[model samples]
Target: MGQIERLADLVVRAGVNVQPGQGVVVDSDTAHLEIARAVVEAAYRAGAGWVEVIFTDGPIQRSAVDHATVEELSASRPWALARIAEWRAAGVASIGLVGDPDPHLFDGADPARVAARRHDEVRARRDAMFAGMRWSLVAAPNPGWAKQIFGEPDVDRLWAAVSTAMRLDSADPVAEWQARTATLAARAKQLDALELTAVHYLGEGTDLAVGLPPNARWTGGGLIDHDGIPYLPNLPTEEVFTSPDRRRADGTIRVTRPMVIAGQLITGLRVTFKGGRITEVWADEGGDVIRAQIDADEGARFLGEVSLVDRDSRIAKAGIVFHNTLYDENAGCHVAWGQSFPWSVEGGLAMTPEQRVDLGLNQSGVHTDVVIGGDGITVTGTGPRGTVDIIRDDEWVL
Candidate 1:
């Protein structure tokens, strides 16, 4: 098989681990038809009972934001909500393709309006997966994504970069991923032993303290689905993470990597948190876009996740900015605002909304990751053992 075909097999066997006779869903953009089709075929080969393909159109999505009335944009689509219930009931496995083909599709649109509509759409899918459905999100190489990264539509070069980050060039990529994930998992256990109450990040223009829940447990490598099937939620995964104590994040943090939200690029972003709430949000570009998102709900201002990546991480050492959060966030230490993962804190998966709120677990429907650590950024943990170095200058020392 060719490299792309090999990637398809990995997405099935490793990404989500499609089981025999399982129903699979392939959610993709029209621009990623080639890889999507390959994935569909791979699922069938893996003995998937059926494969359902859903295609999203970027231009159509942009047009809706451009002309739709505020009231219409604000209303949740019943059809979308109904589909989530169906997927959850059927126990379907979903593989959503990432990698925006047209990063500037919503460039001229109103940032607030764009964020609102995108949040509404994402809520349905996120709800489905969080509810019970098994899912994975992987990226595909296309001309538009290639052009955005290399400025020349050189898809081959972009693939090479992605492959290097994914360790796809290995003779047995699946085995390589398995080995890497195991190593990372061992690191997570060591971190959990620290019994950290919080982590402090210090760097130029960055001094932020992110609190962890009382029983927070670090998890990474992969996650267990509702039915006990394990899957890596994000392809090319590298970071081990835990949900934050949403009520305790404070200080200022300067984002080191560029991020895109609702098709807009955010760079040189700096945010300040006071009383666990975002008091300031600024960026050299796309500041309005991020601000609009942070204002989506009360929980959006607080942090949900904090992740650590060492300098030796494949994605970090690749020395190329994929501009895709799936890849960029794995390049260094990062934090996510909104929607705490239930798995991060003990007994969280069984907690109700009120209980979650009381425990300081963020309940926002949004989960936006922002990379904040790179060169000069040092992360130290405050735990039962007192303060200990976790990451020093992008190196995972613990």
Candidate 2:
């Protein structure tokens, strides 16, 4: 089989684990039509009852942002929400092909509108996340993404890097993932054993304490759906993460690497927090976009996730910044300020919003991750017994 077809098969069989009689949703950009089509075909081959493709056109989105009223843009298209709701009720699987071809398509538009989000849509999607949706996100290489990485459209080079990151370079990529995910799962168990009350990140201008409640569960590798079906929610996964108490983060953190938000690259970002709420945020580039994202909602200013990735990550080893969160966030330890994964907390999935808040879980319409740990960093866990190191000098020690 061709590489794309092989990749599609992996996405269908392992990514979301399309089951017999299960309907599937494939989300893609216009630039990734081929990959989406391949995934749809693969899903059908995997005995999916039906496969649907949802396409997004970047240029048209740019036009809307440039001319559409904020109210018009904020509706998030009720028809789209209806589709998601329909899929949600039917228990459909979702697969997304990312790696936008034009990261700059929204540049120069009103950053406010560019960052404007529909809370209704965000809440609906979050409701289906993991258990309800059984989703996976994988990258699709294209000329624009390649150009951003290498200053030229070298799709072959981009594909080579993606293949390596995704472990497709191995003779048995699926087997390799099984082995690697086992290791990550083992590490997660160790962290869980620690019964950590909080995790401390110390480095350069960073000395942040992210609170991990007693019921917080650290999860890595693949997620189990409602039916106990295992599915990889993200390809090239490397971080063991948990939903932290959104009310406990404190200190300053210097973003260690660049991150992309709303098709804009943010660099040299530094943020300050007090009692878990973001008090200050600044980035050398794309500052407006990042700031706007922080202002998306009240919950957007608090911590949702704290993750640790060792130096052994293939994405970091590749020595190339994919400029995509799917790859870059795994390059090292990262933190997200927005909606926390419900399953990351024990019983969180079934908790009402009020109950979640009582447990310090964050609920928002936003979830943006920024890398904060890499070289010269120290990660430690502190609990009732004492404190122990988890990662040092980019190596996992727990």
Candidate 3:
């Protein structure tokens, strides 16, 4: 079989682990229809009872962002949220194919409007689904995205890098992924055992500290649903992450990778945190967008997650910036603002939003990750045993 066919199989059998008689929902943009179709076929081949595709038009979304009024931007489509809730209630499996064909589609749009346009109600429903349902996120490379990264429409070259990052080059990709997941799980176990009070990051242009909740659990690779079905949240994932106390972050850090948030490429980004809130934001470009996003809600300015990745990551070793968070965030250590993962803490999934907030878990409609790991970076963990190296020179030391 060809690589695309193989990828579909891997996604169906390994990523979401589709079960017999289960419905599958595939979400993708027009640029990724080819892969989305393949995923549908693969799901049916895996005995899926039914498969549905939801297509999103980039140009239409860009138009909305450019001209929509504040009321329209903030309005939640109840029908849309209801559809997702119905799927979740039916135990449906979901597959997301993401790769922006035009990463800068809304580059000149109003930053504040763009930030306010996110569907807050839909976002909350999605978060609830994540706590209970099975889903997978994977990439679908296209000519436009390839051009953005390599300065040329080299689709084949881009596919090659993606295949490597996804471990599709392995003789038995399924077995390879299983082994890789085990390794990440072991690393998470080690971090959990540390019972670290805080994590300190030091590097050029970066000096920050993040406090962890006592119940936080570092997790990555695959997660099992309530019914014991294992699902990989992000394909080509390389980081082990935990939810940090929303009220304990301090100091400043620089973004090591360009982040494409809300259709804007933000570079040279530096953010200052005081008591876990984003107190200052600076960027060579797109700072307005970052600032606007941070002001989205009361919780948007606080830290939600902190993840660690080593230089040995497949995405980092590939040495290509994909301009997508699912790929870039895995390439290095990163931190996010808004909406902490419930699965990252003990009994988190069952806790009420107010209870979670009281325990220092951030709550907002936005969750944005900014990478901050590279050469010269060092991370140390502090606990009852005192400080110990967690990462040195962009590699894991623990």
TM-scores vs. true structure, each candidate: 0.97, 0.97, 0.97
Cα lDDT, all candidates: 0.86, 0.87, 0.87
Find the 10 residues in a row with the least total lDDT in model 3. 117-126
Q: After superposition, how far is residue 115 of candidate 3 from its true place, in Å?
A: 2.0
Query: Over the stretch 1-398, how does candidate 3's per-residue lDDT look in tens digits?
Result: 77888889998999889999999999899999889889999999999999999899889988888788867889888777778778877888888998888878878898887777545565756675666678888989898789889999999999899999999998998888898888888889998888888999999999999999877888967898898877787887788899999999999999999988867889999999998989999999999999998888888899889999999899999998988889999899999998888778888888887888888888888889999988888999888888999899998889
Error of 1 at 367 (Å): 1.0
Please estimate how well model 3 matches the true structure, expressed as its whole-model Cα lDDT.
0.87
TM-score of 1: 0.97
lDDT, candidate 1, 1-398, per-residue tens: 87788889888998889999999989999999999999999999999999999998999888889898656777887787787778778888999899989888889798878887545657677767777677888889888888878888999999898888877889988899899889889988998898999999898888999888888899978888877887888888899999888989899999888877878888899999998899998889999998888888778888989998878789888888888999999998899999888778788778876887788889786789988878888999999999999899888888
Colliding pairs, model 2:
none
Give lDDT: candidate 2, residue 362: 90
Model 3 segments beyond 4 Å from truth?
none
Q: Which ten residues in a row have the lowest lDDT in candidate 2?
A: 124-133
Tens digits of lDDT, candidate 2, 1-398: 76788789888887898999999988899999888889988999999999888898889888889998777777767887897788888999989899979888887889899998778887888787744688899989999999989999999999899888988877877788888889999998888887899999998878998888657899988888777888898987999999999999999999988767777778899999999999997878898897888888889999999999989999989988888889999898999999887777788888888888888989889988888878888999998779999999989988
